[model samples]
Target: MNGAPQVQRRRGFIMGFGAGAVAALGVAALIAAIAGDFSGSNLTSQASQVIRDEYFKPVKSSVLNDASVNGIIRELRKRYDDRFSHYLNPHQLRQFESLTSGRFSGVGLTVTGVKRGLRVASVLPRTPAQGAGIKEGDLITAVDGRSLAGVPTEVATARIKGPPWTPIELRLVSGSGGATRNIRLKRASVAVPVAVGEIKRAGTSKVAYVSYATFSQGAHGELSSTLERLDRHGAQGLVLDLRGNGGGLLNEAVLSASLFLAKGQLVVSTDSRTMGHRDYDAIGNPLSQHPTVVLINHDTASAAEILASALEDHHLATIVGTRSFGKGTFQEVIHLAAGGALDLTVGQYFTANGISLANKGIKPDVRAVDDPKTPQDEALRRALAVLAEKMAVENR
Candidate 1:
């Protein structure tokens, strides 16, 4: 989710845009000029609402000389209820910038809020997070001097992140063994990779492992580059890992699925009042012919669900993992006045076959939950077996 929104591009969604704002004010103004009982409290509330909804910033006080108008705008703040209203001032804007860039001055690990606390979901490869040995499932207790019991996930992330070359301390409890560790790191500009590919033998079958960390700004380009490398490295069978990955961009999901499907094939479908489909048939695709198996878990959400559902519906790959995180709503960011932006869930996505997965997530054909400490690699093993059979049939 893009936490910060740009207010200029969303003129369609915000009603304050167009003459409607002025018109709304004009209606109030006309009434103010002729209405009876001008000193009544109810009229005062009504006038204040006019200033808040109709009046813009750096106002010409001479026009809205009514004190009631000013009070309505300031005291009531009813304009914020429009869903398009946003309050992202300069400070909020800066925080959003850091989140989108991916290259933040921090320990370089993506953490999420859970029942346990702020837990380290995945330690980005080759960053200070990895160097500090912050494993997946490590519940963070504190950062610097702040306690991490009730703060927002972003706030906790900001606590651990800072300007380049600054020091930050963290206390953690491991999910694997309940072991505790205290580590201090010098935050730097962490360069997160787009796609991660490793071609190795999985016990007995030769399955290629491809993990996507996040859908960052340049995700499509980065994923294409990674696929090229994997193709060169002799990846005939694929294990596309999507566990613990909260989705990034929407089109990136479509583009990533496009690489593995033929032209004119459906990738993902969207729902408005009616259903609509987005086709993925870009020319000169890379992995469209390869037999791929997607690895998913509970954390797979949004764009991840889109990609998984697309491939399964199109018969491109067999989804193998626990049930997905079940987030099927797509949000559209609308720019608001006052410099902030609004992110509203405007659409719902379906599989390529047009089966909506809004509240219900995509169910894997093969259910597997891989937990090493407890020793259950059910999903992975099933996927490996399927790929092994595929390879055997192809070789024969």
Candidate 2:
């Protein structure tokens, strides 16, 4: 009840229930036993009976024999229509934990599905993906001699990740070319860049431009330090770039908002049947009250949307660019006694104004589209223009 081992034992008992009667009683009878419809069919009794059953012998021999049980769990989620719910195997759980911790063993390319193949969105700095010259916009066609044409993006990404020092071959076509080339690279530990900033001239005045990659652990601390450095260097305004960001931890999202909002200001809230209603407020000191603009696009999601929505709702910053990705549901990672974890959708999140952002993303005040021919971010340029105008008005 208290530890993970206990939870695992409970899960094991549940699965082992009616093992002997499984062939005779079947799944329906098993459910009835669990529901207390049958006499002497309590959980413990049923579990003991199942464990002694001949069909359950393989389960006692190896975890691999639990495949049927795992399949059933997956089918249940599908029947419930919750695509966000996941039953991660041990290996996947390890990969996910690494990702959330800001480091993982992989080629270090952030990718999305495209018409032909998986498109390279961004290559992390100093990683194997970058080292192999896999720049943004490369379309991956195959992995390790396997053709990924028409394969799901999620499956392709899984094939790309593995233990460090392992070799992975990628066949890809350039974003602008017809020729396809194969690149062999060794996977290595890649750190996710959470926050980076620089000061840029906006209308003769210098404004800080900060790009937040994700809301990983300790993200607020990183962002606060970056902004503080910019403030010390005479930053007149700020451009918070949330383009291509896919969001991360929820608490980190609220913490990031705290950096710009007044103490105790409402950031977000959650609505659910089990958890009821919960509100999260900004707790830390305000970092910068300077005229600011937020840059967002279709890839900006979840926690990123939270920050954008909060800033816009509070009239704290001018939002620019396309609508956000609109991922407002929160997930709770429950570690199983087996080996992996369950990422279950817990609840839908709402902005301070009580608007649920589940399917309806945050719409920018000044919509700007990026040009396909140019490498420059047009949305960022528009944000700078908006910030410059605000700064000019404030000075006047």
Candidate 3:
């Protein structure tokens, strides 16, 4: 998990134990099951009493706002016991939806809460982010005059995504060069820019390139289709360019990696005390049987890590990149006593091979330092070099 609680590198948030683990309904039900009078409002009444007596009365904490209450519950659970909790507010709900399903109109960039304020982790090249002159070391202090200090990451995102062509101004404090400037960008669909291709050289070797510009729901379909086409095109070599990819859906990561793995191999799994342990696997033979390579950088994270780890674990491909954003943790989404939901960290994850690429990203067998203006990839070069060596030995 490169961004704990991130999946567009967005919807990636925190989760907690099961609903039963967090909810009073279970308490109410259990109480009623024993008392034999479990009913609607009565459950709520008893639930409130139980919660009030257990938490509020003890600490004299009186919170009504759903978001605040949820945050407190989560804080308590994470700090103290393993009790389950969640957060639900209008902005939080909207942000959650946008992260998971809401398409935004803006350049895809990863911003995080760091010691030096909000720092830009990486910028997808040639997108609005690059167009706006947004660099990797910029610090986002405010958006539209809203100081991002103490703001939830999701809330910061909702502000970032707006109507296309509508200028959004970002106030920043630079990380390096000690230069501060306001970066303005117009939001647009961060899809279509990413491309996947398979290259076949008669006298040389086959090549497959999956150029990722940003994370999108369409990314999985596109990547899968590209793999299919490469297989059809008789590709013997593969190259996955995650140079600018900011990451996406958690499940998709598993799906993409599974495509190149043997059947019955586990891909990913979650570890939450309340949320029953779950695991994923390759449903079928993923490879048309081609050697592969994955390219990543400081920007690659979350779902990206998931895919990279799977292929590497299975020895299906070699990972080549500078280093990856280390983010690993699972969040639970709980239905609120209100109407919305809660995004809280409930578990952590591991590759089927049992390696947790959480804080430590997948290390390349061959490391390559990315030179932005160079336009040539050293990772691909090393990957090609390795694949060639293997192919040469096979031919002999």
- Local accuracy of candidate 3 as per-residue lDDT tens digits, 1-396: 323332121123223324444444434544554345335455445545445554434532234345356656667766854322346475567775676465567676766554334678666666788887777767888887777765556666677777677778888776556667787778766644555575744238766666755556566667777777876766766777776465667776766766677777888887878877888887775657666667887667777778787877877777876777766665657676656666666777887777766657777777887444456755567666766776666578
Better of 2 and 3 by lDDT: 2
lDDT, residue 255, model 1: 80
Q: Scored by CA lDDT, what does every candidate get?
A: 0.66, 0.78, 0.66
Worst-scoring 10-residue span by lDDT in model 3: 6-15
| Candidates, ranked, lDDT | 2, 1, 3
Question: Which candidate ranks first by TM-score, i.e. highest?
Answer: 2
Q: Name the runs in model 1 displaced over 4 angstroms.
A: 1-90, 101-103, 113-117, 141-159, 171-173, 177-183, 202-207, 272-288, 372-382, 393-396
Q: Write the per-residue lDDT of candidate 1 for residues 279-336, one digit (tens) a residue.
A: 4443336463667788888778878888888778877788888887777666654554
Candidate 1 total steric clashes? 7
Which 10-residue span in candidate 1 carries the lowest summed lDDT?
Answer: 9-18
Q: Decide which is better by TM-score, 2 or 3.
A: 2
lDDT of 1 at 377: 56
